[model samples]
Target chain A: MKHAVSHIIPNLTTLTASQTLFDMVPLFREIYAFRDLLWILVGKNIKIRYKRSALGFLWTFLNPVFMIIIYSIFLKILLSFDARDPLFLQRLVTGILVWQFLAMCVGDSLHAVLGNASLVKKTSFPRIILPLSTVLANFVNFAITLPILVVFLFVNGTTLGDMWLLPLVIASQFALCLGVSLILSCMNVFFRDTEHLMSAVMLAWFFLSPIIYPFSKIPEAFQRLALLNPMCGIVTAYRTAFLGTDLMAPRLVVISLLMSWLILALGVSLFQRWQVNFGDKL
Target chain B: MTTPAPIIDVRNVSKRFSLQQQRGETTIKAIVVDALRGHGKRRDFWALRDVNVAVQQGETVGIIGSNGAGKSTLLSLISQTSQPTSGTITTRGKVSSLLELGAGFHPDLTGRENVFLYGAIMGLSHRQMAERFDQIVAFAELAEWIDEPVKHYSSGMYVRLAFSVAVEVDPDILIIDEVLAVGDASFQRKCIARIDAFKQAGKTLLVVSHDLNTVHTISDQLILMEKGQIIATGDPDAVVAQYQWLSRETACTAETKEWGTGAVKIKAARFLDAEGQEAEELQRGMPVRIEIGYEASRRIDAPVFGFSIQTTSGILVYGNNTQIEEFDLPFIEGKGTITLDFSALELLAGAYLFSFSVHSQDHQTNYHRLDNGHPITVRSERRYEGVCHMPVRWSVGKGK
Candidate 1:
């Protein structure tokens, strides 16, 4: 009977691809199984990122801090933009911190596979770990910049109204970054054009996000469209929850969170499917 | 112990590839025209065709073939790197292939970091890789450089680390294709020892190599392929003998050489055994006779009758002339025949080139020559090996 059954299955030669969602369980288990590899890969990228550089980890903090200062000057002095509430610059800095995380994740994640094409073509590990590791490494960079967000709050003499929700917001943004990065990284393998196209798109995405300007500055007609940008909701929520800004819309946050989860699940499945056959194409 | 079922069964598997050759398509116009007319299209190439083999658990098999003979393609199919274009190959147990070392290495990552990354890629868990990490570094002999980025490693060091990581993973079914040719001799010896140990532990191995000695040492069975088809398969010694015979019989015809005509013309040539029976099969350490017939348009004196036998790498194994034998023979006019009788051919199993030549004895200049004469196949008849199987005496340790 065993011999008979073995002859019946076609393509059984290929480790028999999983047809059901439960199949993802083993894949996830496999990813978890290689957690040290995941952590070490993330750690290695972090180490090599600053290796041989003078500023080292200080550069991580300087990037967002410098951007916040530049944008603060541009908005307060050049554009003469100020909220009647008197905490305008603090709110803008909050948005920039979140935006920096989003930008870095998008920027590095697109080349996650191409940059390590050697690893992609040679090893049979879960390919998602690559983009996941990039996101994880970027998280470390984001963590160093978080202190600045708190400094902005302290300087503004703001109260932490619902600041306890900051971790949840950060987690949501991470999920959203991973979901989008996964899709882009997979696509990057087939179309190298995605790498260049991504940078241009992200620049436009930044302006559309409420990072540089205030949400109140936008016409209400376009407010809904602005909220649709995933990072806009996260950044706005961070400003509201932490610095006591009133820009948060719970409805938009919920929508983006749900969309993030949906994209994450879909992206994971697509990346897994494409990964199994990558050795052939790569 | 109960006999194991054939854990690896490959049946009637074929892999076909589509090769595209486009001409004069600088602009979009050519592509549009070709797409419209459906002409000047891609061609189908069969890298492996209708191959069938089964290995019981704990078997060691060697796959030998010339370049583009589809050796790598066959191993790739078995390893599932690429799906077979047709038929089936079913294997049970974890499959690991070392098609090329350092294939997935990240240059920017340190050796230690690459170990984990490479481990995960090869499907090993963190704990598993961690447990073996020290041993891997020790085996690769890169202890001091483990923390340095892999980009800084020399070519030999890279292969050493890559190979160490691969072998340490311990998958059930291992497929290797020409990956052992790197590193120094000591490392190669260490690798061969590890493979032997793996076999002793009852692992299944499929090895593809041009190093016939290593293949012969490690493999219990063999398969020979040519032009995408399986030509022979069986016990290691028998299959190798047959492959060498096939290689030689077709040496003139085997597609290994492209024939050309210059001045003197080779009429007919064939290989024969000592009994004068025309045969392609030559036994190692046995006399091999090569006979050739050639027609010269003009008279030639003291012609340096020579033949050169070469390997696929174009490495000359041996070349000599009849003048060295001190025989003075005169070539009259039209046609003549020459026969070379050897006391014994000591070459291990390999394809060798044979050619007939008539050079100016005084000047040693090429007059009229057939560089690749009729092909002569030589193979090992004895179980002993090395570049040449030398006659030796041995003494075994005493037993009570």
Candidate 2:
């Protein structure tokens, strides 16, 4: 026997298993309601990454500085890459920082969902928050270290050209990282081989993107194909904004922005599919 | 029909978990292998059947069954972690499962920090958790250790703090699996009291426990399942009773039937269902037997062996002895099992105690007596609210 229920049905909190996603409205709302959870996870990432170390939070600033020093020596001194160029160290610093932010997000995401298997298997929070938190954590770290970049720029005496375009490019790179992170994180959940494969992929991807080398160095015929990487456009835009290198055409940056969001949309849909059985996979 | 919309409505939902997925095998190898094999060869194990249940806004639904009965799977489905392979589950408001107690907890974080982080995972904003922070700390009784990292806390302390943080989130719909069974006895009692208050406040609840008595006493409706299929779901008493009987037929899992003393000490006792097979439970209005095993130290004269079924509260439902039944008992010795058969037991659906005794016929001496205090579960299909089900019919004649 059932009673004639008189309760009103409010919108937005209803969930149907048949289609948990694809309709982004409620997904966005769920994510919004759990924004506090997202922030906490991001905080956890930032804190736990350097826990138990003597130079804990200092590592965030020191890490990039050291990488810049090591790679500059390995590249310009050892490999003699554009050794005569006076501003080569500045270029390397700016390029490495941009690359490191993206790398942290996508790289961390490989373990984002897998490492938190307990969370994924037990609770039903917005799962995107996992990969998204990695992206945000790296973003926050990057934001906190902007002063380091600014300090470097001032020390080098280089004028930041079309400085406003910097935020747009940074935002573009965040989207690219988030999209790829989602894909890699979900893939890693079902296939541990993705971890090995992702490391290899990220290694190759580092070279594929123009972090140390200028984008113009790529053969002229391949430049059009390289723009499709999204990161190429991003890295180029960042160097152009900071070092005042020939600013990559506005149209190319626009193409990368569109590509970034498109990949993000693809990531969301694929994540929905992969995540359906995440508890089992994890 | 004005059917009041239940806050949680699960309709014909089923979930199939892939074996390959559990083994961490992914698409790339499977894709290439499947192409070479000329077909899809992956296997899926169905974890749930067509389970359909609806719970009104304030109803408490208790799920009980043996291991691998898909109880947790159903909870996960309703809680929104794992999606169903087929069918739809719709729930209103936030559904937080205690199954994920302390989920996302970092061992390096202090107990206080873990609380907010754990709270945040359950949908509590930092400000909201901060508002309840002091209360949570006091409830966990971990004030001294709150600032210490969770890794330093004992496992019991970890669970205590986690349970405290979860209770404070106070979602509209709560899912708990063996949560009340956690912590020490005193902590468990505290959790039960808190859960009772939550039930009193009219929150929709789905609770799962192997402890049948607790679930039976607390739930309005009970679900019994076997092999991912619902065997029964209805009034708590009747469903619980049926689960006992069904479990007897399915598995040999029964309580080592509890307290008694005497010369004719009831070494052990068992109940037989209508089919005359040993079971942990008996069906109401069905023929059953209570078999008592005893080992007498020496020969006893004119000993009266008897049994009494009483309400758990000590009210007598029925009692019978060999002398009362006009059977004269001779001297008894050695180990043996004696059975008392009932054509049909009419007790209502509730736990009742069985008291077995053997004494001198004149009541002058006691040879042996065993009141194991093991409550026998009598299941019923009808919802008769009392200690016994009376055979009565209503007639609407003029004389009536």
Candidate 3:
């Protein structure tokens, strides 16, 4: 009976692919089975990215410092925003540091799946591992940049309030970025237009979120609509935890937490469903 | 005893590729094409069609096919790199596939770094890679350059490292494409020995190679594919014979053919360079040598060895003989060599077929004649055009 059935179907290649697309249990299991690959890819990404530079991974922290100085000069001198505003630097630093993880992951993973099409064409493993590792590597960089926020908090004379909730905020943002990265990267393999359109969309997303601008400045109606962008709630959460700012529409945090995971699940499902044909396309 | 469920089972597998969208089209260009063509033409390309096969454990199956016959596609399906458009392929045990040269290696990373990275990509644990790291470096003979970036390594070195990693990982089923031909003779021999060990073990192996002799000897079972379908299967010798017959029926192209009498025999002939390195390719204006190794079964009097260079279209470019050059050997016995040396090969950038023959100085008795139409490519950097390069100097001042 086993011999007859083996002729009918075959081994793990067909067995794993036989599962329904919605049955993500196999995917998660494969991910767990290939966890070492994820870590190594993450390590590889980091080393290849930074090894050529003289400073070597120090740029993770140094990046935010450079941005902070440029933004300070742009806002205070060029825009003539009052330097007397204490909370301004705190808001800027929190927003930029948190936002960097999302930008970097989306950018890197944009090419992660497509750039490694040669590997994809030859080898078979969980395709999700590519984007997952990219996001995790950027998260490591995000962790490294957090100290810059600590220095900024001191400079602003802001005592950390509700600081423990920062982990939840980080988790929410990670899910959102991973989801977006996965979608963009997967689509980039097929359409390639996704990569070009993504840059424009990200620019719009950055301004829509209250990174440099304060949330209170927006009109009430626009503020409610802006909350639909998960980064709005995410950036606000960072400011709330660090600078003791009011969490406008307190459910925004919960929305962020829920919406990000929703997108992440959607991204994972679509990617797996479509990846069966990825090798053919590549 | 039951045959352990046939380790690999591929059933009625067919892969279809759509022709609507050209592959590797840039997004902007794709969008433009979409707007311009607007689904003007639609056709589906069948890369594989109703291919089926089953193999027991410890079996070595060699797949032979002309280009684009879907041999690579079938291997991809078995390795689970791509799913078939229809049908199912089941492969048991750990399947390690070496599909192409320089598989997924980061060109910027050092050889040491890429080894670890590639191990992980092949789903090997860090500990496994670490354990075999030394052996991989040693087997590839790249210990001296392991720390150097792989981009700097030659193609031969790159293939050596990749082959070492795949073999050392001890996979249950090994699938190799045509990467084996890249390494030098000794490295190739070392790899063949390791592969022989794999065969000695109970592991399954699938090899795809254009070198019919290697495949015939290495594989006990052979699969011959044509036009995305299996045309022949079973014993390697029979299948290879069928493949040869079929190709002969289809293509009446002549290759190296030699006819000789019983006196003298030409054993081997090869092209060499000034440094005595065996030459695969040559550059214009480089010193070249054509050495013919011959054996006289019995004493032969006044045998003349001749060499000819011809264009692929059968146009003879140069022909010379020992008798014509007035270089004579009274008699030759046992084994000896006839060397044709060129201070500078003046042929331009193109391919040429070589011919070697031996006969009596009187041209009455033909001991051997060989028309070797195997094309050898000649390269040149200078922009001199035509079938031959001539040294020239230019003085452009008219008043002078």
Predicted structure with the largest lDDT when compared to the true one: 3
Candidate 1 residue A46 Cα shift, in angstroms, is 1.8
Question: Which fraction of the native contacts appears in each prediction?
Answer: 0.28, 0.59, 0.45
lDDT by residue for model 2 over B189-291, one digit each (tens)?
8877887898898888899988777788789999988889888999886787667655543333322243333566767778888777887567889998878
lDDT of 3 by residue, B71-148 (tens): 998888887888787787777767778886645566777888878877776667778789999999999999999999
TM-score of each: 0.84, 0.77, 0.76
Across A76-100, the per-residue lDDT of candidate 3 in tens digits comes to 6787656566577668778888878
Worst 10 residues of 3 chain B by lDDT: B245-254
lDDT of 2 by residue, A180-229 (tens): 89999998876778888777888898899888788888898988888888
lDDT, residue B376, model 1: 56
The residue ranges of model 3 lying beyond 4 angstroms of the native Cα positions read A1-11, A15-22, A73-84, B26-40, B249-400
Q: How many backbone overlaps does candidate 2 show?
A: 6
Q: Return the lDDT, model 1, position B265.
A: 56
Go through the candidates in order and give the clash count of each.
5, 6, 2
Candidate 1, residues A45-136: lDDT per residue as tens digits? 68767899998877887877787778768977787756554667777777777887777878888778778767655544566788999999
